[model samples]
Target: MTYKNEQLSEEKVFKDPVHRYVHVRDRVIWDLIATPEFQRLRRIKQLGTTNLTFHGAEHSRFNHSLGVYEIVRRIINMFEDRPHWNKEERLLSLCAALLHDLGHGPFSHSFEKVFKLDHEQFTQRIIVGDTTINQILEKVSPGFSQKVADVIGKTYKDKLVVSLISSQIDADRMDYLIRDAYFTGVSYGHFDMERIMRVMRPIDDQVVIKSTGMHAVEDYIMSRYQMYWQVYFHPVTRSAEVILTKILHRAKELFEDGNYTFKLEPVHFISFFNGDVKLDEYLKLDESIVQYYFQLWQDEDDEILRDLSERFINRRLFKYVEFNPNLQMKEWMKLYKLFQYAGIDPEYYLVVDSSSDLPYDFYRPGEEGERLPIHLLMPDGSLKELSRHSDIVEAISGKKRTDHKLYFPKDRIEELEDKQLVKQIKQILYGQGEVENVR
Candidate 1:
């Protein structure tokens, strides 16, 4: 036994676009990745319905997990000889970073929003509870699993390990920002990742960027802001979300009404409808299962369910126009009334979508800010908050960008037999009636 923990006999490599290749040296990390539960991430899309908007965004959570792991591996390599960076915690940090998104379910965000599920809690359950992940984690040590969980939960005592995974400018963000940009074919996410990696240093339990790399950090922050508005919060994506939400609502209502019957109870949906879901059932539910049910519902007797499912699956997304939350109130009300008159349900067919995100935020004392602020290490060994050092971060700090749009079935309205009514609705929506008659 010549220090067997050094490396695996057969090195494992996951082909990844973001990091090029995810290399596994420790047997523990290799075993964890081989677990069946981890394999399930292959089928779960990282961006979910965003693929419908960005055709190239078909990458899975498996892709992201490996990318995160690779970034952590590189950062830890940089910290090997540095102060405050423990060699003991190396595997734990990589494990935590890799499995952070393991608990994400199918269409995670929309599903969680509609059903009140927290993926983070589910993540802990999968890691510490009885499952392949738990077993794999326990292989390292009984207490080891909890340490990995704690790092992801952001409750770990080691500030350095927690910061690497959960901090504002950590491996998770770094991987996603770059990976998402590459897959979506956008130029905004092209920050100098190599420079950022080189600038990282571990100092007394906190990781900070070297002041020389402030420009690289600024580019990363700006890139994140651009991606949020350009891709993550696109109005079209929100429109699909609205439709998915209404689909869930309709299914729940039909279940409650007790008049309609489903071919199957859709057991996975039962808990969500009843507002109590179990982790095992949630884990079993992936995008394929959801799409399977949607396909089945297409043949259901409920016209609303069938139609909406078809729309979602077929990319018949609602068209939208910029809406003013303040000035469009009356117009929105009139559009609601007109929808009813035109036999379209305003609740399902007409929607106003609003999305806002803060790309960067400064520390606000006693406020509800969750993420720790990014810090840059000055030459004299003192740390400066990122916004204070970088002009790009200063410009975007604490400024939340918001976008609003009113979504409607442009196809339906265009083809509406009642041309005059359609004209009026179009006038209210676009401020003029240039809409062509539904041919």
Candidate 2:
């Protein structure tokens, strides 16, 4: 038997809260899972700063990665005897699904934004570079490692495999939606995944749902919409993200100034501060390491660094007000100046954050990041794009929605020595009357 086809004497199963049991029968898949690089995902969060809002969202990327692998495994099993299904691609698909998120750093989104790094590129490196994962993939075949990386990058020639991992409704999204919802303890992520998966059929280069499963598909789309607004884009989560971003900014600035002294030197951050991080340095970072720095920086002499570190470590997130830069530029400037006058650094303390989503979209041939439209296979073998038949999906198809909020420290604003300035800020934020108790 080929290395890729080698199965264990007995199947191993991992009990998962979302998928019940994640089974591993292939020796290659099991070996990859045991690698140190793959194990590192246990230290990184699946949802950055979201746990601050939904306390139950403390699950790590390891959990979600395993869930994704299991979903792909089930999909491949169903496709085993079907026409146009390539059994040769089975191991490749499973390895790609399991290792897709291997390179995610601690608080992935915020870290990427602040450091100008791409986790996807790191993932490619871990797969193709000289690493344990690469070693195992090489055992399968000299070229197998590159194939798995190409699959995750969406550059693989097998359009069918690419669609399985990345299309509008694929294993990655399907797993994360349910897993995130389950861990976050929210009702929005629940949907008939089994029904949808059962109806999935591979036709041409894409996976299509049978016409009978249209309602389940509709429910899945609606569930995604609710989760985006309710859980993924929660205001409190954004507040924590804002503070986290500011903390990184302040630390980088202080490091470049060449005069500030850190109680614990950010050995892991120097390469990042210089804008060229080595893979080894990057791999050494996780949420625990980041928090360790935050804990020590709380005693730093720089007040901004110390204060921001304390806020993040202790969960003292910023308070936000609804403010649109397009409509409230003058008001935003007024607040910016007022904050500076009040001894709070406007650049660090005042922030505006925005979140946007395109609920669903049909294929736009030449568009960048174009999503392959979800199609339904009719009894007569005719295919129809989803939005054409589903009213709820049609209402949101191709529509982009965005929301913005202005964040500031409520404690600092309330304790200002100048009451008139505080009153003006409050009036602008909460109308022309006394500041009501708002949570």
Candidate 3:
């Protein structure tokens, strides 16, 4: 049998905590799962550094990728005999979904922010480059690898297939939401996923929910919204991320200085620190490898590098206070100057981090990074944008919310021998003995 038509003799099932079971019967899929590049995901965390915050959140990208694949598989099964669902693109969709997060590195956002790398770009490169994944894809047919890349890249001619993987309510988000919720042991990410899937209809170029499932869709949207604030954007988790990012920054700064002696050479990070990472070099660095480097740097001579490493390794995370950048610029500047005077590098010690999301939005022409809005397939076979049809959705749609926190080590500030300076700093962070938290 041709690889395209090949099926396994027996269905291989993975016992999944969230999906119950991920079934694999196709030989191509089974083979893709066994590829070295795909296996690399097993070493990368699904929620980078979040395990520190939520002890149960140690799940890996491999886990999330499989959930995505299974979701798309179930979706395709429902779409097999339905209109506007191209069965010809089934394998392409499955392949894209399975390998969608193939390029994520260890501590993905920190590395991306520090090195200016885009995981999605790396994902496409892995598919098209001279890798085993590319070889397996090409075995199905010539240029099949590129087709999968385009699907993941959102540049494919088949918009319906693209929507399955990249839309506002795609399989990726659906899987990550419930799966992250499951692993993190949170109740907020739970929603009527099965009902939403049941009512999904493949329109000309998008998937629309049956109006009967509008409530389920609203639940899903709210689940995503809450998950962001309560878990993904938890201040403690961001504090961990802040330290991780600062570690990378310090390493790169030391690398550029060109005179730092290393107890153990940062061979895995040399290319990343230089901002000229190749695919092979990129693949070699994962969470385990990065953690090893972080461990070694804990003993380094550079004070900033050593302190940040020890803090991250030993869980001495920074404490945060809500300081609105717009209104507190003067306060921030004063604190920055005081930190420098107190012998701490404000550039590394005093940092502000922000997270923002627009729960839902209808399309606005000529906007940057525009997200397509969810649509409801009305009873009369007409389409209506979700917000217009549901009061719950309308209330939150197109409303962008941002949360900002200034992260600093409260320990250092509290331990300041200059008690008067410590008092002054505390007053700015905590006005009237209470944090000015912005929710």
TM-score of each predicted structure versus truth: 0.94, 0.97, 0.98
Q: lDDT tens digits, residues 319-430, model 2? A: 9988788998877777777787788898988898999999899989988988899999999999999999889899999999899999999999999988888887788776
Q: Kindly give the number of clashing pairs for every candidate.
A: 2, 0, 0
Report the C-alpha lDDT of model 3 over 243-335, residue by residue, as the tens digit: 999999998899889988788888888988878999999999999999998999988999999999999999999999997898888788878
In candidate 2, clashing pairs total 0
Q: After superposing candidate 1, which stretches have Cα over 4 Å from the reference?
A: 1-6, 433-439
| lDDT for model 3 | 0.92
Looking at candidate 1, what is the lDDT of residue 411? Answer: 88
Model 1, span 1-439: residue lDDT tens: 3222557878788777777788888877787888878888998988878878888998889899889999999999989998888998988998999899998988888888878888888888899988988887776766788888889888899989999988778999889989999998888888999999999999877888999999998888888888888889877777888888888888889998988889878888888788878777777888899999988888888888888988998989999999987777877888888889888888889888888898888778788755568888898989999988777788888888888898889888888898888788888888884434332
Using lDDT as the measure, the top candidate is 3
Give the poorly placed runs of model 2, Cα more than 4 Å off.
433-439
Ranking by lDDT: 3, 2, 1
User: Which of the predicted structures, 1 or 3, would earn the higher TM-score when compared with the native?
Assistant: 3
* Candidate 3 deviant stretches above 4 angstroms: 432-439
Clash list (residue pairs), candidate 2: none
Candidate 1 positional error at 256, Å = 2.1
